[model samples]
Target chain A: MQTTRTTPSRLAKRAHYDEATIHPILDEALFCTVSFAVDGQPMAIPTAFARKGNKLYIHGSVGSHFIRTIENGAPVCISVMLADGLVLAKSAFHHSVNYRSVVIFANAEKVTDEAECMEALALITDHLIPGRWDDLRPTTASEMRKTTVLVFSLAEASAKLRAGGPSDDPDDENRPTWAGVIPLQTVRQTPVPAPYNNDTPLPDYLINPQNT
Target chain B: MQTTRTTPSRLAKRAHYDEATIHPILDEALFCTVSFAVDGQPMAIPTAFARKGNKLYIHGSVGSHFIRTIENGAPVCISVMLADGLVLAKSAFHHSVNYRSVVIFANAEKVTDEAECMEALALITDHLIPGRWDDLRPTTASEMRKTTVLVFSLAEASAKLRAGGPSDDPDDENRPTWAGVIPLQTVRQTPVPAPYNNDTPLPDYLINPQNT
Candidate 1:
C-alpha cells in the first residue's frame, strides 16, 4: 500500500511519504530512534524494530518507563535512517548528508493478545536474523508475560532522503577546493563465539546471513 | 577524563552517566537523532553532528522549525548510537543488540557569535571529512548569518552499552540450538562522484578520511 503524503513534521522540502520509499529504509536499518514525550518533555531512545505490513513492533521489559510511556498511547515518533554518505559542499552552509530517513508519527498501543504478542516477538527476532527464531527453544508463557510489545502503524509517515552530490555555490565550483562525497557503508563483521559456546560451530544462517 | 555519570531519563538499569563512556560513542557515530517539541508534540530528525570538548554543534538553515525550536532553548534529547551486532539468544526474551549509545538532554542555545559559528561549521565539516574544511573556501559573511548553529552541552547525559554476547538464561545454554552474534559493521564505500563533477579527482581526505 502506498503511504499517502502528509505535511512533513519538519523539513517539507525533504519529506517523501510513500510505502515504496519507506519500507526499504525500515528493512535495511537495524536500529531506530523512538521519540516520545511525558509531561511535555520530548525524549529519543534508540532500539531495534521490525515491520510487518504497516505495523512496527518494538519490545521492552514490561516495567520499563520508556515502554510504558509508549504503550499507554503517548504520541511517538519512530525514525529509521540509512546514512549513505557525507555531502561536503564548497560552503559550510550547504553541507548536508546523503541519507534516507523515515519519521513515523503514531500513538502506539500495547499488544495485549497473547497470540499476537508471540507473533510480534517472532517477527522482532527473525527481523534481526531471518530464521533464528525457529532454531531457539520455544518461548514460554512466563516470558511472554514478562515482555511488553507495542505496535505503531505506518499509516502516517514521511521519509526524507538526499542523494547525488554537493549542491555547491556556483562561484566556488571553479575554485581549486575538492568537493565530493566521502561515502559511508555498514556491513557485517565476522561473528565472535561467546566464551560459553564450548565449540558449537557457527550456524549456516549466521555465516552467510545475507544468503550470499 | 572519565565521563562523570549523570541521571538517566528512563530504564535505570541501562543508563550510564559518564562523559568518558559517552564521548567515544558520540565520536564514533556519524549521525545523531535530535528530538525537540513544538506545541508539546515531539519529533526526531537525524542529522550530522560534531563534538568538541563538551559541546555538540549541529547545523541547519535558519528558517527550519527543527532548528528554531532547538535554538529557543526548548528541551531536546540528542541521541547517538553505534549498533554493533545482534545477540540471538536461546529465547526471544533475552534477545538484544551489542551497541554503544548515548542520550544527552539539554536546552540548546544558538551559536550567534560569528567567530564561533565559523569554528562550529569547520568542526562539523572536519568531523565528517577531516581536514577538508581548511582545504575548502573560507566561510563568507553572508553564509554565517544565513546558517544557524546550536550548541548542546554534554553536562547532563547518559551512555549505555551492551557488548560481549547475549545474556541468555543459563538453563537454555545446553540446548543444541545455534545461538551467537551476527556482528554488524559500518564502513566507507567507494566514493560516488557527483554527476556534475567534471573529472575533479578525489581529495586525499575523501580517499583516506582518518589520515592514517
Candidate 2:
C-alpha cells in the first residue's frame, strides 16, 4: 500500500502514502466524491464518509443503484480534498492551491451485520458533527434495514498537500505584483434554529467552534 | 442531459441538471476531484479547475501521467462540491451537510491550438483570483510547451444542492433536541506576503472581499 508510484510524475514530492497524512485529512473532510466505472464510462458522486478505525464507510439506501453496483464488488475510488488557501504566485505558471487531499483506491463491500450497520450510521453522523449522534434518536431496526452501508479498507491510499505561501521562482522576485497566501477557511456560522422546535438552545459543542 | 434520474433515490427534490445551478457551483469551487478508470480500477484525484464558457479546463505538465492519459482520450468524471453547512436533525438518519455539488461525466480532449491554450491558461488564472492575469508575469512560449491543458464539456453535467435547515420526520418533531443548520462558509483571510517580497500592499480585489 505504501508505494511511490501512486504519486503523479509532475510533482511526486507532494504525494505520500503515510497513514499519518491520509487519516487526518479523511477525518477532517466529511464529504468525498466516490468514482466508479459504469460500462467503461466513469461516474462520480458526492457522498458523506466516516473513518471507523481503519475502514471508511459510506451509506445509501438499498433501493439505490449506486449501492447495488458496489454490492457487486465494483472497483471504486474515493477522493477527499481540503482547499486551505489560494497561493498567489508572481508567475501564473506557479499558481496553486494549498490543500491536503487523499485518494483512496478500494472496493465497497456490504455490511450485512445489523450491529455494524448501526455503528456505521452513528459514525457517519458523528463524523459530520461531533456529539450530535449522542443527542439524536438512535437508529431504528427498520431504518437500518432500509439502508445499505458499504465499507472499504483504507489500505491502498495516498495523500498530497502543499502548504505555506506561493512558491514562486527566484527569477520573478522583482515582480511588482503582490505575492502571498490568501488563506481560505471553512467556518461555521450561528445556527438557525428549526421552526416548531421550541427555543432549544444550540449545544455547547457547536457553539464553541463557531466562536473560534 | 438534464434528468431527474441524476438525483439519488433518497432525495430527488435536491438534485437538478440545469446549467444555471451547475455552472455557479463549478465557478465558485477552486478544486475538484477527477475520477477515471485505470486498468479496470477507478482512480480519483484532486486537482485545480477553471470554468471557461461551457468547458471546464484542468492543466498539468506534459510529464504528468494524468495529463498524458487525457491526451489519450479516456473517459473522466470531474466532481466539485461546496459544503455550505451541517444540518442537525432530531434523528441521526437525517443529519447532513448543506452542500452544492456538480458531477461532470465527459471525456477529456487536449487543446492543440496555441491561441485557445493561452486563453485557457489565463482563464484558469483569473478564475482563481480576478484581475490576476494582467498583473502577473506573462507566460513564456517555453512554459506553454511544457504545460498541457485538457478541456471537457459541461453539457452532460448535473448539480445537487441542499440549502435549508434540518428536515425532521413528523414523528421526531417533538424530540427535545436542537434541530437546525450551522452554516459553513469558506472565507478568505488577510494575505501573507511572501518572505522575499518586502511589505507589498494587498491587491484591490483581495482587499475588497476581505472588507466584506
Candidate 3:
C-alpha cells in the first residue's frame, strides 16, 4: 500500500503525524467521528473502528445508512481524537487544548468475501481487547450475515497531535489567572464480574494494568 | 428565540430533552465538531465554543475556511460527545459504548454587531473557565478584527445519552471472558506554571475540580 502524509495546518497543530505518536493514539481510541455525504447532506456518525496494519475497519448492521453509503464507494473521512487535557490559558483567544488525533481520508470499500469478512471482524475484536477472539464465543452465521464491514486503506492518512503544557502569551505571564495544562487520562478500572459467572479468576489481560 | 427539539435516532440514544442534561453538557464542553459542506465536500472541524443562555458561540479567524463556509448560511451539524466507558461485552458483535452526547442541527448565522461580538467572546471565555473573564486581559481591537464569531441558537438541538453497564447476550453470560465497563473520564491535573511566571499562586478556579 502506498503511504501518503499530509502536513499539519495551524489549526491542526494539536494533531501529530509520526508513527510513534499516531499508533498509540489510534490504539487507545474506541470510537471515531466519521463524516460523509448522504443525499447531498453532510452527516457525521460516531462508530467503532479497528486499525490493522495500514487498513482501518469499521463494521455495523448491513441496513445501516453509513455502511450503505460507503458500500456505494463514497470517500469517507474518519477522525479519532483523544483529549489529553484542557489547556487553561491566560487569554481567551490564546486558550487551547492538548490533544492527540488521527484523521484518515480514504475511499472505503465493502468487504464481500466471507473469509475476508470474518478476518476483519476478528481484527476488530482483537483491536478492542487483545486475545478476545480466542477467549470469547465465536460469532454465529446469523451474526455475520447481519454485519457489514467496511475496510479503508490508511494510505492517505495523517496523524496530527499536540501534547505538553499550555502555550501562553509571554506578556500575559504575570496575570493572576492560572495558565497551565490539566493532563487527562483514560484508565481501566477493576473489572466487575459477570452476574452469571461461577467466580472464575479474571484473565491476566483484564487485570494487568500494563496490558491496557 | 424559538425552541424546537429534533427527534433522536438509534445513533443518538443518549440525548435528553430536559434542561438538566442539556444545559450541563453544553456548558462543560470546550469544543465541538462542526460538520458542514464546503464546495460540496463535507468536513468536520473541531473548534472552541461557548454557550450563553440559549445560544452557542464559536469564533475563528475571518480568513479561516470553516468560518467562510458557515458564514454563507449553510446548514451545519455541531456535536459534542463525552465517552464515559468502554462497554466490554461477551461477544464482539455486541460491544458498544456508554456515552453522553449532544448534537445540534441548525443554520448558523454570523455575528456582525460589535456589541453582540464582544458578548459572544466573553461568553465563550466564561464557558471555558468560569470567572475567567474578570481575571484575564480583555480582547484587543486587532484581535477582534481578526476573528469572526458565529452564533447558533441552541433551540434546535437534541441531547442523546447512554449510561450504565454492558448489554451482553444472555446466552454468553457464562463465557469466561470478563465483561464490564472500563470507565473513562476527563480529569484535570495541577496546573504547570508558565515559563515566565513570577511564582504567583494558581487561581482558585484552576484549582477547583468543578471548573473542569
lDDT of 3 at A51: 80
DockQ of all candidate complexes: 0.63, 0.79, 0.53
Candidate 3 chain A, poorest ten consecutive residues by summed lDDT: A1-10
Better of 1 and 3 by TM-score: 1
> Candidate 3 residues B1-212, lDDT tens each?
11333554345344466767787888766667888765555667777788877788899888876688788778887888777666777887777777777777777899989989988988877776677778778888888999999999787677777776677778887777777766665655556765655566777777766535
Per-residue lDDT of candidate 3, residues A1-212 (tens digit): 11432444346444444666666777888778888766545667777788877788888888776687777678667777777777767777777767777777777888999888898888877776677677778888999999998888777667766766667767877776667766665655566654554576667776764323
Give the B-chain TM-score of model 2: 0.93
User: What's the ranking of the predictions by TM-score, best on top?
Assistant: 2, 1, 3
> How many Å off is the CA of A104 in candidate 1?
0.8
- Clash list (residue pairs), candidate 1: A185-B187, B3-B18, B3-B19, B3-B20, B5-B17, B6-B17
lDDT of each: 0.78, 0.82, 0.73
lDDT for A124 in candidate 1 is: 80
* Candidate that beats the other on TM-score, 1 or 2, i.e. the better one: 2
Q: Candidate 2, B11: how far from true, in Å?
A: 3.2
Poorest 10 consecutive residues of model 1 chain B by lDDT? B1-10
Answer with 1 or 2, whichever has the higher lDDT: 2
For candidate 1, give the lDDT of residue B182. Answer: 70
Which has the higher DockQ value, candidate number 1 or candidate number 2?
2
